[model samples]
Target: MAGLLDIVDQAQAIACEDILKVDAFLNHQIDPELMQAIGAAFAQHFQNDQIDKILTVESSGIAPAVFTGLALHVPVVFARKLSGFYGENVKWLPFADMQNSWWISILITLVLMGLVSLLLALNGFFRK
Candidate 1:
């Protein structure tokens, strides 16, 4: 998906020399076509695997996750980042100290990757 990088480079804005703001197309104002392309890429990469569900966080992840789910023909399970008044009412997985919003996404992604790896190992898909 060389076009994907071009879109990113063209739309992405650099802030404070480090932070990249992709609100125009990625996080905030989403481009459906780009999301579909991303989903197709993910589906192609993991086509051999048995993907029962696509796990992602709410808001930003929902779009791409939904597209990926459609491409993979699987359900999308989105995790809520914010807690309610009755924290007990919600099931929270204390995976990490979620201070930064970006870190929360990263942590969730890592957890999903680890879970996938574990499942693959258990299913003997990783056997050489």
Candidate 2:
């Protein structure tokens, strides 16, 4: 008699040591199915916008970065955690990597803002 939302809530609340345990496969191990789903979601979210590239900080971001790049069919670039003098044409972005996945986190708010601006600018060009 429960609705879908209730089921989802229950699922989220359920605690299981076995299920909660982080295995080498689920995350770092790289399950192809999960990666594909992630990629699909990323592609769907960005479908309206023309994304030329995907960027993230180096390290654990590599996995999601690869999925996003596959979804966009574009090259993926990761910023090195350590920066050097004379940073060339590089801009800063904030992202979050829990579990120490990546050394840096590109702020989600800024990413969305940048994507919106990029889309708007591109839309203007296509109309010409």
Candidate 3:
């Protein structure tokens, strides 16, 4: 596994006196190899857990989350970020509404309930 500093060094950047931009690799255009390494590292840490799903925020997280999901042989569910523009209705339910605090609460509750249920099921399987 590459060290954190090594990864940082590999990152492309536009460094000014105090500011830096890593969009070329870290955010805007991702490096697949790095993402895979990241996913592998995360998977190694939680390998003991019976992970049924990989949940993450949209955009930047999708790539590594997908890699982790594949590593764990689980499904990936990313929360969508609402924008000013709303296109045609998609199939998946809206995971959150940033403008509405109540909606965020509901989403959190749902995610927690699902996780608890999954954990219980896994425990039962292990006990058998």
Give the top-scoring candidate (lDDT): 1
Task: Put down candidate 1 lDDT per residue, 9-128, tens digits, no spaces.
Answer: 887566657887778887768999999998998999999997887878778899889999999998887867667633458465564355686687677779987997798779975443
Overall local distance difference test of candidate 2: 0.61
lDDT of each: 0.80, 0.61, 0.74
- Model 1 Cα shift for residue 91 (angstroms): 24
Off by over 4 Å in 1: 84-128
TM-score: which candidate is best?
A: 1
TM of each candidate vs. truth: 0.61, 0.45, 0.56
Better of 1 and 3 by lDDT: 1
lDDT of 3 by residue, 23-105 (tens): 76568888788788888888888899878788788888899899888887788888786874243465544654447856776
lDDT of 2 by residue, 75-128 (tens): 887767555533354475233335542433335446865896698678873232
Listed per model in order, the count of residue pairs whose N, CA or C atoms clash below 3 Å is 0, 6, 0
Per-residue lDDT, model 1, residue 99, is 64
